[model samples]
Target: MKTLQKITVILTIGLALSILVVFFTTSNAVSSGNETIIRFGHGAAESNERHLAVMKFKELVEEKSEGKMKVQVYPNEQLGSEAEMIESVTFNDLQMVAASAFSQYDQRISVFELPYLFDTYEQAWQVLDGEIGQEVAEPLLEDGLRVVAYFENGFRHVTSNKPIEEPEDLSGLKIRTPEFPLSISTFKAFGSNPTPMAFGELYMALQQGTVDAQENPIANTYASKFNEIQDYLSLTAHQYMPLPVAISEEFWRTLTSEEQEIIKSSASEAAQFHRDILRENEEEMISKLQDAGMTVIEPDRDKFREEADAVYEAYKNRFGEDFVNNILKAVK
Candidate 1:
């Protein structure tokens, strides 16, 4: 009886040890094989469509990877302004950023900001999704950033306290613009004094009359409720703002080819979803702005186009006439 009891105790001890070994091994495997976390940052308001698209990207990546890859988004400049965020991504301090191309104007990516460059969104997409887009992406590689996709930033329009029936209406008005030189020049061509300001401070600036007007997409104008302080919505559609979805090249190169492919595919898929949503909701955004008591003005588009020519002439030499001509040819 004594021998049998000893045998039973030994067996029980062995079983407990086996269970602990299995648990430890499984835990180590999970910890080692866990998906990498990518941090994405942007400077748009939480209520903006761009923010919503970021959320969608988060969901899509996680679902496609079965949670093996995760996207964490920082909105409302939680990271910094667009230019700062781009610098962060370039240094690998941040994994990803969705920033307006205008912020990189000094880098020559702002060539896209030339007025009336895109007659239609489709034409813009073809240029962005093709060889020209690849060429533009090449210059950014030196900054340690890789372009994943081009997300729609929609067309830009002017919002001011006074009505803008033509370029004359913008004369002497102080307008707030992004930090891009092209944007400043474009406003200048229209006879307005452009002031560069951060997106966060724009509302207060308008309220305090620090700047009399600003330009942004209908969605942004409505989402920020800029319509409240501003009286007229001039549909300038001067520039097609393309939000470049970029990843740190250092981080991207560290991934296995398979992992890189996964992320690129997921980003492309999410970008299309974003564009579809924007197009569907554009009309609704117009309606909402009208309901919010903002007067929407459809100006003589041709006049606006002609005024934009001055901007092209001024910057073409700097951007390389070949690059400019190629882009224009691609779009045409």
Candidate 2:
């Protein structure tokens, strides 16, 4: 009977040890299955559309992945300037980023920055969201980047401390432009001194009179409150700014095929959301700018177009006449 009791005791202890082992193993597996986190960076104020769109992307991506993925956003150059962020993506330091095509012009994405190339937002979207946009993404792929979507930044306008009623009014003025060669050339064509400065430094430069003027979308001007320091706004719409949403190729390749689909789907949905918001808010943005004491001027667009002619002539070889013609055709 004592022998039988010993066998029972031993069996009980063995059962307890087996249960403990399974419990610990299961706990470790659960911990190991936690979601991956992605950091998305951009160079815009929190209140700006670009920042808002990125937030929307985060929401969509997280929701679509059912908590299997997460996104953390860094706005207002907390990560760094646009150029810096792009480099971070290349080095796998940042997982994703959204930046103006102009900021990436030096990276050979300047093909999208040709002045007067896209006449309207729709045409620009068709070209950018379609095959040509995919082509533009090709170069970045070689640099360890993946383009997901293009968000419309809208048409850029000139805001100056002086009243600008015509192309001639731009003469001898120092205007702050993006550090893109094409942008500098565009302002130079109108005889303005183009100063390439980071967007974060622009407000101070204008306030201190370091620059006589700067150009941006009306919404951006209003959102940034640039109208407070500037007296005049010319509705030149000379350039169409588009923000390309990109991810680090290395990070992207690490994901499973299903995971990649989830991210791409979420990004595409967020892109459309941003476009819708811009369309709805455009008129209100213009009204807000006018209310802020900015004298809005409607100059003879043809004259401005005539001045921008030289930009094409100088860049035709680099951008190719056929490419330029394709853009014009898409807009038409």
Candidate 3:
């Protein structure tokens, strides 16, 4: 009958329209005007290379998307502590964060932070860009973290009120470290009192004598003007911190496939730019630190390396006795 045919056509057309609406809503998570916004947060100073690279990332993302996407970056703990920002990401309150506090999320990540583990940047990159790095970042995926790029923080060094020529020189001195457990254990092995604190509070803490020393990459030392308060800088190269460009998995799922590709490639390119800047300025920054009146000291590394053995003994069994060695072997 003609009436039956009309009903069948109407049902088919309605179902098709419903399917189209569902697909459009799920495929493109945009605002009313088709604009998507990403709120990115970090705890680095404005002058830090990471911040500079993030600016580049913003530029790249906007340019690639032709203004369809926007990135709003908050630096210098403006979004709160690293832990708070990470928590925000999990709940989808924040879209992205440059996560430097890896050890806090997973202890397996801190294995890379062990003393004397990376003798050169090349070795560190080899492992990070390979399977080892993928495996480490994998655990956090379960917690709603998705790593898009690895941003470099460079090798950490010690800065104190007095010269640090050996572990004995550091004896009894309270050294400021991140809440990272490996760093605390490493400093303890070197016979120094490790006082864990946030990076933003470090300068005032040093000025007020709350902590006697701190270790960081040369770039961070210079950016923080550690020379103004700390009188000595030692090239400890204890830990190579490579931060992650982390995005909330929930937020990521909302991005269209094209938008996701733009974000990922932009982050990767920007991070590479940051790594190159640190590498190019490694020597220049040290010279500038010396010029700023901080005495630069290169202590006997063999003695420091020897002391690091204790740190390995402390965490090896916990991280799988062979885990550390396997990473070292890959880089070698």
Candidate 4:
């Protein structure tokens, strides 16, 4: 009878130990299995500021999440073109994309494409980081995308095989531009025959003489090696492009409030890092272009602005004077 009691006690203790082990194992699995993965895509090369911003976001998010989250970045359109990547993000196939062409989704975003919209980068930031940007980005939420932060594409300048001393020089020239309506309007106002084309096709277009000129920030122009194909770099300062860090709203809905806050804060930090790097290298980029045998011309910006008044008038007509007035008011 005593032996039977001992066996019963031993069996009970063994059962308790087994239960404890199972409990601990399950706890550890739950903790580790909750990790989330985010995929980010952009069309720029690895050397571009947009890609660098993605890398920075990845580092910050992983550190903040304590390994609970991971970010995978795809550069040079490995995922797809900008428009296609944006579509994927909207459908939740991709988590994020740094898209310069957000204007395509909402016409209100075209306000950023307005020629000579901001006199200085500081002024531009004041509007973009304030209520104005939020107002502009409000429409994106309806399309299953959210704007986390605004990025700088700097001031766009013209590069062509021929010298552009004035807006008149662009007369009848076949100029390549992004498929943004405001950009086309700006170039058309300057008398160029604006041809909208994909960014990836631009190099071949310039090389084969399909287009006579193209405009982009100095960093992009240098990085894309346009200096080899184009002879002149005209500082048109026609527009200050604003790129947006956008995330999938569907994916956003799946995140906890804390996670969403972490992502937003990280995106803003990465945007500042990107802007600093681009500003620091802008002068060096121009110098490199000059060294590559491209003559740099600082055109009379006032003349260019004066010529683009009609385009601005059209914007006010299309978007309403009050809508246009609100953006201009934010600059002050």
Candidate 5:
């Protein structure tokens, strides 16, 4: 009878130990299995505002998802260039990218490239955060891309070897522009010789006189050290550029609705955070360019706006008046 009791006790203790082992093994498997990984790519260097926003996005997503999702950022074209990144994300080979030149893929995005579009940052934000952004972004879903947020590249300005105080001053000057039709068109309308080139080749293009000038946001100008090669920085504020945070439709479909909302909300918050940093540092950038021996020109903005009529007509013909009007109405 004592021997039987001893056997019973041993069996019970063995079962309890096995149960404990199973529980721990299952818990570890669950912990490791639930994590979803996102591979994000962007063209900006670490010092650029675009990359800074990307870092903020990583933080927000990780915090909100409670470690269920992990974001891995590849900056400075480590994964690929802007256009290449967009293509990868669209096919879902890459989960996400911060895309500045994605208009080449979807023409609807080209609307933001229109010259003299927004007079102020406030006006740009109103349109971007409202119906116009939604209207423009909606079509991207069909192309296997989802615009998670509209982040700022800020208002683009012109950097020249000489002062560009008026449209005539830009005449016949070789200006490097991103390989976008609207960007080329904008400079063409201003009577400049617009050369479409990759961003990586720009500094050399300017130095070698392959291009005489270029246009980008103030933050980009400073980050690229255009002040060293270029003599003048013109506050053209020609295009209030919006860099899209894009996710692949395939990857997006895999996410739960709750995960999607967390990502979307995180992107929007990061965008605002980026814009605030840019605004606070804009004057400082301009000052730094001046300190670096570049001439800063604040041209008659009205003069630049006046030349945009033909450009507007051309865009209206391409995108339709209704589409253009909707964007205009949003700012008001």
Candidate 6:
């Protein structure tokens, strides 16, 4: 009888533990009969600031909406490339994406990608958070994407097999640039034979000598482990790229205005979180890149800036000269 009782006690304890496990596991979920699921995707790794901020958005949304809106965050292109994910959003296959190349949806946005557009981070934020931001995002809204907030990609710098101290230094070097036309034109103006390539193909392309060099923000370069293959990290600060936290307009229209406000505020707060973390860790990222044996070269930015003027002129012709001048005036 004692043995049978002991078995009964063990079974009872096991059942109780399982009950607790279920409760704890789902404790954060919305306790509602009807719940809305939001799928948020990005191309950054889990360790990236982008991922962390995205998780914070998940936390805030679930907590604020009391489990009414459940956010599913997918990092490292689990959904697909930024472009593919965005296309998915348009069709409602996906709900959201943190993508840097929103310019693809509207070519006018590419003007902001012009090199040295904003001299510092503060000035960039000032312009983006103000009227210019609405102007940039308005085009996307018409195209089925609603931008919540502008996330950071930081300032882009060049990484290569040789030291790049000036525009002439990049001469004849075939550098991998994003397939974006503005990027291709900018690098062309810089004297590089710019090869349009996908970001996913870059590492192997570098290792196999398919491309001589590529450029990215220091954090992304380090996170992607490009430092292992590249020799010099020239601080070009050529372009300031911002990842837009965007949602499907179709999905957005389904939400109540209150739910929309919740998601919007959470997105804005999360973007601020990424900005703070990026600013805090930039110095450490540069040090780690150096420790890993990549030489960090601070190039004469003025020379690069001067070369970028040709890109601006190209934009003026591509876009209207008046529109380009208005953008230039806004930053001032």
The numbered model that scores best in lDDT is 4
Task: Tell me the tens digit of each residue's lDDT in model 2 across 99-207.
Answer: 8643453344666777777777777888888887887677778788898998768788899977777789999999999878888999999999999997878999999
Provide C-alpha RMSD values for all models, in order: 9.4, 10.0, 9.0, 10.1, 10.1, 8.5
Indicate the TM-score of model 3.
Answer: 0.87
User: How close is every model to the real structure, measured as TM-score?
Assistant: 0.87, 0.85, 0.87, 0.88, 0.88, 0.88
- Tens digits of per-residue lDDT, candidate 3, 40-104, equal 88988897888899999999999999999988889987988888898878766778889777556
Off by over 4 Å in 3: 1-32
Identify the runs in model 6 with alpha carbons over 4 angstroms from their true place.
1-32
10 residues in a row with least lDDT, candidate 6: 24-33
Estimate the lDDT of model 3. 0.86
**Steric clash pairs (candidate 3):** none
How large an RMSD does model 4 have? 10.1
In terms of TM-score, which candidate is stronger, 1 or 2?
Answer: 1
Worst lDDT 10-window in candidate 2 = 24-33
Better of 1 and 4 by lDDT: 4
TM-score-better candidate, 2 vs 3:
3
Residue pairs with backbone atoms closer than 3 Å in model 2 (clashes): none
Q: Model 1 RMSD to the real structure?
A: 9.4
Candidate 5 residues 1-332, lDDT tens each?
Answer: 99999999999999999988866432122224678778888988888888889999999999999989888888999877788888888877788888876666668787977888888898888788887788898888887989988888888899998889999999999899888888888889899999998888899989998999999999889988998899999998988788888998888888899999999999999999988999999999899899999999999989888887788899998999998887777766
Error of 1 at 136 (Å): 0.7
- Supply every candidate's count of residue pairs whose N, Cα or C atoms clash at under 3 angstroms: 0, 0, 0, 0, 0, 1
Model 6 C-alpha lDDT per residue in residues 210-294, reported as the tens digit of each score: 9999988878898889998999999999998877888888888888999999999999889889888998899999999999999
